[model samples]
Target: MRSISEIGEHHLIRRIRERAGDPPSWVTIGIGDDAAVVEPARGELDVITTDCQIEDVHFSRAWMSMREIGAKALAVNISDLAAMAAAPRAATLSLALPPALLVDDFDAMIDGFLDLSRLAKVPLVGGNISRSPGPIVIDVTLIGSARRRRILTRSGGAAGHLLFVTGSLGAAAARIERFEDTNTQGSYERSEGSYERPVFLLNLAREVAANRLASACMDLSDGLADGVSQMATASGTGAVVLSSKVPVDPTATLEHALRGGEDYELLFAVPPRRRRGFEKIAGRSTTVTCVGEMTKAPDLLLDEGPLGGGFAHF
Candidate 1:
């Protein structure tokens, strides 16, 4: 297969646009344009989020396939949209590629990403591609929309709201730890199913938003501790997370579940009054679990002590 250098940028861009297929009606303009133009639904507010994945930092080429890497890049951004209970509309992907990267590998990666995009009904609208000096980088910017009254945010929660999370936490972190410890991906391929496609929980988020069930919400990209801290800080409240209540992944430790990050599960707060409604909606999903509650005080505590650290970029 030809390397990116052999195909050149313009031709590669054409191939990408061709693979993206036709844009949906809401997209006034898609790829091959100076910028994307999209029409939002009446009375709906837009929600936008961006996420980046870099080789070595986010994934190792030695273990992760390009397809898995691409799916993960889009999945992370989608998780952000899900946190706001928004329906995805369009996405832009910016890629920084080494000249030596094979065209076939890039195609495979795009296929992986597009597969998820189609599943989510998010069109590939626009983006830029450039040659990188070193490792590959995939960055995605996603745009979504939700009715103003139905949008969820970290600042809306109050001290008396019950804390809940969708799906178990720290499985991704555990997978990473296993990879690091073993230095081989072969033994854990079966377990890595979750790492490839992190749960977005958009449907559940929408239900909570539409029913006004959640007072606050965010995705757990940085683990439960960080999620709790952020939500509490934004809402001008404190949090009391119970270690015993946390639904740890089978292969992960309690610590991993608390601060390992990359879980991509929805973390939300429901007021005591709305508990019944929230529970009714969430009960449809067996993965939902209640971990703790918001507090009037300003400290974030796991049990009786302060919360610990999670994944940090720096």
Candidate 2:
């Protein structure tokens, strides 16, 4: 019931450590330090990604609990790791809390972090918290690892590589669209699972990397159009996306599939010769669709013509 201002920074941190429990064996140092320290086992490279979510800008307390917000924060960061085929290991959080925020909400938010950290096998090692003059802001830095040979990047693609994406697109955008049109995104009491949950293609990405099934890779955060354009620019190749082949949610329009953001699906380029092999390895466990092919023309085209772009923050 108490506000964060009442307990002060020291006590609030003490409570956080208490909630975090004992550090895992790999952690050489944890909270209470100027910085965390860790020693990874030999033969693995570290993969790190960070993200920031602000109240109202990224989410609203009226729609989700502070805890759900916490989980979503980690999910987005993990999505970046998924793009690199990284196995999540540890995380650090930076929180800027307003004076009027309740202590209970802080605890709930940490609870969300704990839930995801466990699911992703990423432990909370260290972080910082400070007073904010305005809305709640959470910045999470997640560290993951993969063997050097298994790391995937966006710049490896080439002409004749087929572009593949995991799962359906536009659901998150559709969810937000529903929220806006209906005036109630979802029951304020329960967060919408589609937007709250992020799909991390850890297994699939590893398979693609290990087998050399993909030539280039990145997460489809912005829509398919943007994802293809990005991969094209990074690999110095053009992409020809089939307008009819892009997968979309039942509720979303084709435009939503093309321009929606925050899908978190993996957008990858595979050689035509490896496409069948990738599909065989991908199996029926999840949807992996080939929506386009890399081209030598150096242009992003849809069905042999120019394609529109997704949401732009600028």
Candidate 3:
């Protein structure tokens, strides 16, 4: 068996296809496209989330520019808001920078953060910056507002619900491996291009919120399997994913989809009756796959099999 770095991106995604499954009711879209959309609330629901990016753990200076780092940090957090089908209004950023980094580079990083903020139409209201003895770190907290009935959450899923994901999986993993290979050949541009630019699925979120299509929702920052498991745990339900139907990146392989993190896509669930509406909307867009279904059991299964392998954080 080859490691994810050796299998390349597309091949890794192919592996994920073998274990993917469908989502529950209200999930309008799932993996194999640019974004995921879900409806979990009826009227209005507020959304809140926080995420952190560490220099050596989440990223490295050797492979990422300060600008890219800043943008990615902000994008990941906003992606969380999008998962809940909420409109992000403001964010607070906290930065811990090492003294070794030049002041100009720091300024560029701030510019990058601001760039993403403007693009998302979310203001950077306040934050704290300080020196760090180790590598750079960034923590961002985002606040979003949704109608009380429109807010989506990870805990609403139940038995007989369908499963869904937004966007193709494994692109980021493929990009990482590609970067390593290209860097060895002194071709940095191609490697950089493989790195995913943060995508704001605000439009999809708005649609889901307005429609009340998702019973539960969460972002795939870790991995598809892990994200679904989190949702299952939150909702006190079990799930079964079909290994063959998972939507993966055309260029990525199974390994990438199973273990790669940082995809920053959305994963959601909905009841069975609402699956048609989801399919109808998804048909006009990119492929939104039915990867699995929810169960009353508390276990999370992949490809209708036991769950053991996937990404994990220590």
Q: What are the Cα lDDT values of the candidates? A: 0.86, 0.83, 0.70
- Over 158-262, each residue of candidate 3 has an lDDT whose tens digit, in order, gives 998999877788877777787676664322232342223343466675576577777888777777778778888899998888778777887788668766766
Better of 1 and 2 by lDDT: 1
lDDT of 1 by residue, 1-314 (tens): 79999999898889888888988887898887889898886788888999999998987766777777888899999889889989988899999999999999889789878888888888999999999999999999998889888889999999989999987888888888878888885412434445333434887788888988999999998889989999999999999999999999888999888888887788989989988888888768646788999999998999999987667888
Tell me the spans in candidate 3 whose CA falls farther than 4 Å from its real position: 1-46, 177-199, 282-284
Question: Over all chains combined, what TM-score does candidate 2 have?
Answer: 0.93
Task: Tell me how far the alpha carbon of residue 228 in candidate 1 is from the true structure, in angstroms, after superposition.
Answer: 0.3
TM-score of 1: 0.95
Per-candidate TM equals: 0.95, 0.93, 0.78
- Which is the winner by TM-score between candidate 2 and candidate 3? 2
- Of 2 and 3, the candidate ahead on lDDT is 2
Stretches > 4 Å off in candidate 2? 185-200
Residue ranges of candidate 1 with Cα displaced over 4 Å: 185-200
